[model samples]
Target: MTTAGEAVTASESVTEGESYDFVVVGAGACGLVAALAAREAGKSALVLEKLDEPGGNTTLSTGSVPGAGTRFQREAGIDDSPARMVEDLLRTSGPHEAEELVSWMAESSAEVIEWLVDEHAVGLYLITDYKHVGHSVPRLHAPADRNGANLTADLVRACDRAGVTIRTRTPVAGLLVEADRVAGVTVDPVDGVRHDIRAEAVLLASNGFAASRALLERWIPVMAHTPYHGGAGSTGESIVWAEQLGAALANETAYQAYAAVATEAGDILSWTTVELGAVIVGPDGHRLGDESVGYSAFAEVIASVASESFTIMDQRIYDYVSRNEPRFVKIIDLGCVPEAPDVTALAALIGCDGQTLAGTLAAAAASAAAGTADEFGRTDLAGNGLQAPYYVCRTHPALFHTQGGVAVDQHARVVSTSGTPITGLYAGGGVAAGISGRDGAAGYASGNGLSTAVGLGYAAGRHVGR
Candidate 1:
């Protein structure tokens, strides 16, 4: 009685011959959000993850995302707006190829967060403790643990509820091109067989090439020696595939770097240590440049100066930051951070002269208390100064993720080299040009990476559905 087309529609699976509305490559936060947006709008979507797990670098992050002018911010009595958010981002990142995206993301940030929480049942509460690395206000929203894995899990659950099929360990070998248009992709399964998935729209939300040494050397050569702390699923395959389709790449050299990853422990020391008046010391056990440049930019300074380093902090600052961040509290319990009662003991602990350590801490505390510039020109010292009972941790810089990929419009459509939209092709997250200024780690702002990932994915999913 029913035709073959009706049977395929009834199946709700993306079969080889039948076409879906949206086919999202990658099942990380970006791809999951994109699929959710599309499916929520009554569009058929299929999410393919090359890895067995869905979470990528997103899982590795703290999962903090910013929203401007949200109801939560208003309730918290904080004043903000799209314009203010744009100004903050530009002031940190400088001008770049995707300057317009800064405004676009800022404008839609609140809506994106709201949608994720209200519509998808994702648990995201506004963080009022302190403004992180590159923000001027307390606009960050995160889960209870401040882990992105929670966010990714919520999105996956949302996608499942929306009847979207998410297949893991299914790698997209290449795009199925019909002439100049990208129709779908050829996915390779474990059986060594290729399956064609035809879709009306394709989204490249796979990730950046931080895992690929060749691509890192090609674009971000300066960061070649840095530790790679990105998602294993990222090999620049998605970006390269898109570029081959005439997609224009922009801001390819920009990346998010962290200066405080424990060198031996293989854990992030949390930037809170530095933000709370801690200082980075080189091999000589002397303070380095400004710690206020943020973990992203200061990472470049660390890489250029020394491989072995130490973060010195006081008990009061450590307790305050650890109280707010559960991850740091765990780090404290791990005994990774050694404590010293005073400058002399601290010098003995780090193998340095007591006079030199005493002088450095004294000068820094004096500067913070007097509200004057130290030798490093750092301001905004939390808790005013470091007190007795200090803590020290050996740390190093790491490359988190590349901030460049396929260029897209505000709507997240992959644009060709001529600045025209590539038919049926969309991109977001690390697979798209980021809002950070072109090149180097200096331009990275707080939550800039996740803002682009979730913001652009939200846009692409909604726009593509229409």
Candidate 2:
């Protein structure tokens, strides 16, 4: 392990005898935010990250977080509120074990964004480009470039400015408890030397078990075979440790999956391509299913048809998506998106019958023209119609992350199976039970992950500081 000179927050490596008022596990968006909040509340805070770098899965995401009522939304002339966000989330996620968390986070989301921006100087703007998965209004906020890495960097900088020490390459072996209350965490570094660091309160923001095949098979068997595309540190050790302490688990089977990851390049193709009138087709050049089912739920559609599929879009849709998603520009630069001039050329690309491909496009065009729902019950065709000179990328479905863990109270404190809050033990982000639904991918709304991550982190730190 390196010294403070090599760390992101310019903090020294945690020594055995070091103690803080707040100790946070995982240096992702949640942990950093919690540490910053703790500092703001006049508390000593230290963050421990397993990875050498701070950001975890947050770096790979779009960095979008939902805020129901914020100044940015008000300035954009968008009407929204926490209640509206709760309704939208419930409509998409249906019934869930963490339904209370949905409302709690929704109420705290706007404050989280404002705190990150107004207080910490994290650059965030309201996104008005397109409607997100569950929200009715444009309440989702993101970085200017819409990159999660930028968000992570901003938070890291905020932590540094707040004098929050972050120790990298510090993996927590287990929780240190006294009298059934969490006291601190035992650090297990690569050199195998163990250090017991004490803290008045411990926050588990270490994310979920998306990278753990055994955990996936045990908790979410249906998605056991799905490809994982999250951080390596998400191996469910936090859940295991918490469960050993009799912490209650909720929404254990819920997760988020994406439908269109570029197969060879392993880059996310952005569902905006489909949302803007692109279609995914099977090997036979036949439409797979409704493309507008939203990305997470659409993964099941793609998986049911084939191991891999082709996302078909035209120049208009491609250019529109490229204007917003910078990652798509890189995908195009890598020659991942192949161009086909017409139906025959596209057929040659897919090795399918030209007539079959032509028939499929004709049907979609007919549906768009008539303003009627297609056979798949998709009616919201956004781009009007597809033009010649098509771009098709081979895509596959993958699991982005699991959205389940130990249950937490409204204050973000870990609770017992008997419904009592575990003293000194708080959880947020993927380490806490997600606000998404209890079972499947269909319940995940856009920004649901960050909503819980940042929201609960803010709440946990404030409560601990108090």
Candidate 3:
């Protein structure tokens, strides 16, 4: 952790840079969307990506976004509104520092999705089958293949056609301040040269600090020892700079975690298995805490109690989940998991006693069938509990991303600790305080990350460009 006295300077001295209407840091989904939004408003924009690649965690995600009252939802005969979305978000998040931002995001959800689909020509389909985690209704939209890379590719193509200048391998080292207002950023464009790029407004879409062990230990100590499963570029520099500049931070302890990343191959075992009534068992073949808590919240439970475990699901559940996610099907094809014909065979494969496993599953099955409480108090089983022909995969808890950081206003302008917007400064994506409450993963609803990323970015760009 660098102290306030320490300088964020590099050995290379700062030089001059070409100016633009807006300068965006990090070329992930947020930055891309922001630049596009700026271009649409007749403004010149430039995006600086630290890594060689543009997509950060956005490329690694499933690219799901919650859009209430979207055209796709209307076409699919689903009734939803911004009021319903706000209710769902507030119910999941409880109360937080950013309740007003929640309302703004909910109101802008449909606009953001429609803007991307219509003007930017990004392909998005409404997910009508099932809602995951905290949503009261199905409102998430994703790419056809449910791959984030495809979404990133589309964003890149749109940015290219829109004439947005993206400079990869360029990292912002520090912000340039003049008269207590952020004017631009100091960047290192490789070859040992630094440039001071001035701009009318700056947007920090550089994501969060999940990859930083120091920040994780400082905030969420429970997850400090777990392996981080997010983009490598997220080292907390943006948050650090913003804090040093007097920006207030919130929800620092809240983060998104996965309960079931493959132990052997280190791949994500889709949470759909658990959501569809699969159970996680310890070495003794006993069920863990309520699996209905969803994957992000269950991750903390899995990490604290056991180092490793098996996700046991019946053939019916496996077939149903895999039928939708082709990427998950590839995990099965790679021999990362095993399928067995019966309970005894599955137990042998997972190194558990047959009778013990059978008893463990039977109790849950009885509860699920009765539509009552299970032994672990899980009520919402996606379907009836497992029967013969089961599937099991070895998995462990993993941290995906931090959900909190610098606070921002409705237009994604950075807000100082004094409850005033920091002049000419803006932030979005993981750099901003999230709607997942002040701490813990339990408050996280599905698509909360992208909602903040895309929603705030669009608003910020449109505000600055206009």
Candidate 4:
């Protein structure tokens, strides 16, 4: 351990004057990928993570990721290309996305997936074709276990095999800058020891501000009171550090708000509510938007409401899907359960008007029968009508992560507002602004986090050794 004076110098330089080729902050998806890529390019890389474990929010998430024109897609007879993927993203996320950035992500998505499979040994599973998320194509891929823990473990193993050094329980307090370039990082070890990791290139993959209440309110006002589901270490340290060095910020207002979250005590639960067949309703006891819409649209619907809503469904929906779909079984195991067997009783318990709920159900049934339901563009509901012993559980808007951060060019190089490069620093994953523009398909599932993390990390690492 070092005192404050020693800590300062530890951040500034090392006693041996030895320097690595790259230093990655936050051993999450982006950081791990960056470290692996740097090592692949014959550079010594070190990963600093504040948590005791290696995976950040990525481990907590569902392992599924969207990629276009992948080998898996081709073998499965799914016709997709980078151009189609780019067009779909531009259409779904809005035209405001940086064309250069989106283009890079789209073109490199397949390559990233291939890298994960070839190098990291991430087993691929092709499920439904973009049924859950708003992808226009069926590009989502997952490991044997749907939880992101599989992906994280795979990456950890790969990093270890590749001889990348991972320093867990080490928090990066600040960056060391020489002129406009980032030369190293100051880190506080778990035991309170301070150390300086000097490097030729520094990648800020320290995640978003979702876990920091102060930073959330300052950057994304929509998420001020919303609960965060990511790791405790996602405190926007990189965001603050980068901004202090005059780094440009982009899409500061964008964040990913899951439509339904379990109102459990500590952290927000994201997978259970939506993955199950629960239908969200307003306080008036009427169905809100299509529950099947992607996370963005789901968030928009919930955000449009002034009061918290409820999720209503029947045991039949649960039993049917749970028996038919393995993913549904996983959802049930994750804390998603049906409400009690009485619709009226459940409504009363949730403070909703039972009569109004019945009327809404009847209306929904009629619309489904007539094949005229226009809500959220959900036409599939016409097949499965609501049946008895119904259930309802209140829900609130919860944020998974912010979609915006330091602005970067196509090569993952941080750029200023005046179109000048902020030398030496780079960002990826949630630390980089989303390629999706404001006002795009609010619920489009386009692998905004995973694709950008791996794609930009690859670009940054390739640039580092060159």
Candidate 5:
């Protein structure tokens, strides 16, 4: 039997006397999906979440979901297939990924998206061939808001409609095991009550250890100071319990670091730079990498840089976006400098060397005059140049999410170091050791985290005889 160090309360006792076919811990994307899948299979499922709201960090995310061979792609006439997707992921992430798990993700990604659209009524549209963190293909899908909040809102609505009981502010402290199988979970209700709820299977859909400093120090040594933007509830308590029950962990070192994050706030802001034709420069005011590359690639370079970099652009870039793409204009205007007429003062605020900034602008102008070189791959810069006034903003590498956790098999069963299954327990989402390795932004693929969460959660739900 699983138990928490805390005591049981009156409200927890109500759940303690109950039982379910499937008990899903965490109400984040993966947990919600797993609960829905179990309910679809006619199983009674209960979702235990430590937070009051349903969505976890996912709701706070830019809602880009990546999938290959999706119906949406077919409708859009985008050429894609599971095999090609797998090859691309392996190329980006390398051998650090579990072949079996990666294969499962690539093969079933389309179905997962389809489920969201058809079953959950989630509205999705094909945006630009948007590449995520490290994806080589244009496979990112987003709702109208381009934030995962839409997805989470729809999932929560669907779950509520389907009568999937969600226990908010209730944390799963441990798993209940019967013989070699997980039979239920022990919960610490928000009301300060503790109780045991039996289930045929338990899905640890909780998030990764990004929010838990203690867990990171123990499992991922390199991530001690990585700032987290996701929910604080993703503390890896489930992983800790699984390990206590003899489960093995894998790929505990992988994480996703965004290239340009706001210094005052941890919000991801570098995508605006790329979209607005800005080049990132190091402390010495030199261009760092090809700005034309995707955000993931640039972020990796920034993370490896000795000093945090800054994005340099011109008012013309801002004006072009404001006139053409109003949506992008907001990002640029809010983040860019020289909102006034003075460019040199903006440079001072952004901490760029005045002379060095002037030199860079002149060089860019010469390149533009020659019409031969493109700094970030766009020929538009050939004529435009930064001109007299320029804009710059300080940026730093931001650790937004962890990509690794307890390693699991294809069925989402936590795997032992000896390549054996730790029966009765399962993991998904960032908590499940990520398929991506330590290769940086080049290792990113669109929808890597969300797809893995849904795919593995689905697999785990089905395995529980739901």
Candidate 6:
């Protein structure tokens, strides 16, 4: 007879009150990977996705994950370690409440990458091209396409192979708490019928509350009015359910924002453009604060300075970045990038004074040439200077996702208000407090989201599966 936490076939009918070894809420990378890891440990796992299809905010991302001192990094002749990864992350994020969690993630990053690539056949290659934000080394691993949908699909396929059941259109309404311990979850009303699914352990990987205006206003009010570019499913059911269980929240004000979202194309302009020596200028053709602060941090600068702005890059930079980033290529094909031969023509395009535009470009070029900090304190010019035939795209700032939620332990167990692990309740990804700084978008390093997602997911699964 079937009992709680017993292994079951994927095709078996698990009715209400039946139990799974692990019940994963949300079908993003964190949930999928957690389910896969549980199944790998000879446990029957089930993944519940609120949306009709899988892949939450993870699908909208570039799918790049950072790993320090992996075999892939060794193969690529790069020297790195978990200590260095922690250092890099701490350098970018400053001090945060999740410092211990950051160390845990860094220590497990390489193992997670190896497990995904070697055991599960996830197609990941080390990105040696450029480190991208906040990294002192090239440790990002991504699919050839660098698309999160591909990563999510790979994890889903791996789960399927592992006999893990994934149920879509299944929104979790609340947690099933028994004697102050989570026993399972109550599914939201489905056609007016709700099902109480039980499990030995429950993992909340449902991302964050970026889509909820009320939550945004409550937590990160600075971005409450910003455009939300995150997944619609990020309504923060995890936070709601966990809070009822007395889960202690941490870094609730932190988030990841994108500075250069192409207004016309409705796609991010790829901050790689900025890292390659591009600059964001206001509608008045003046440079915004250091475009090199990384895209998430610069979003606040753009929001404070201009409602609508422009990202200016030359042909060489555009060609280089687009060749590697398929999304950028698509943006170019969509005619989002308009080209001008010189400053005068570019000013005409921006509808700003030519003299002001000329002076801005001239000052930036002088800074790049002298290898000194510009007026905005931007010193890292990846290239010599912006040459003629500049490409300018109208852009705006957008809130990509919330980086904070309920606090979690190193094993991703939800921490109670008393700082104890909430029994049987775990969280990862945007459901947990992030390693990003306690407030604002300035602390986000590239790949921080996915790093936490995959790392904590694996950790949670391993701990619970045992």
Q: Write down the lDDT of every candidate, Cα atoms only.
A: 0.85, 0.87, 0.86, 0.72, 0.70, 0.88
Superposition TM-score, candidate 6 onto the true structure = 0.95
Instruction: Give candidate 3 regions above 4 Å deviation.
Output: 1-14
TM-score for each of the candidates: 0.94, 0.95, 0.96, 0.88, 0.86, 0.95
Cα lDDT tens digits, model 3, 146-193, are: 778878899999999999999999998888777788777888787547
| Candidate 2 Cα outliers beyond 4 Å, as residue runs | 1-15
- Candidates in descending TM-score order: 3, 2, 6, 1, 4, 5
Local lDDT at 271 for model 6 = 83
TM-score of 5: 0.86
What does candidate 4's lDDT look like per residue over 1-466, in tens digits?
1212123654344432547899898888888888888898899999989989988888877666767899888998889898988887777666653557788888888888888797778675765533445566788777665667878898899899988999888888777766557778787787765657678888988888888888877877666776566677778878877777777787766667676654533333333334444567788887777766665667666775734776666675556555544554554555544456666876776677889877777766666667775455555553445667775545666677777788888778888777787777889887887776643227245467777777788778777767
What clash count goes with each model? 0, 0, 0, 4, 13, 0
Point out where model 4 deviates above 4 Å.
1-18, 265-278, 304-307, 315-317, 320-336, 339-342, 345-351, 374-377, 389-393, 439-446
For residue 347, model 5's alpha carbon misses the true position, in angstroms, by: 1.6
- Rank candidates, lDDT, best first: 6, 2, 3, 1, 4, 5
> Across residues 1-466, which tens digit of lDDT does each residue of candidate 1 receive?
1111112221233346756999999988789889999998899999999888898888888888889998999999999998998998888888888888889999999999999999899988998877887788889898878888898888888999999899898888777767578788777766545567888899998889999999999999998878887789888888988887789999999999999887657878888778767898875778878989999999888788887788998887788777777878777788878899888888887788888878888888888888888888898765467888889888888899999988999889999999899888999999999888898998998888889889988998999878
Model 1 quality (TM-score): 0.94
Candidate 6 wrongly placed segments (more than 4 Å): 1-15, 189-192
| TM-score head-to-head 3 vs 5, winner | 3
lDDT comparing candidate 4 with the true structure: 0.72
Off by over 4 Å in 1: 1-15
Clashing pairs in 1: none
lDDT of 6 by residue, 9-96 (tens): 2224334666898999999999999999989999999898889889998888989999999999999899999999999989999998
Worst 10 residues of 3 by lDDT: 1-10
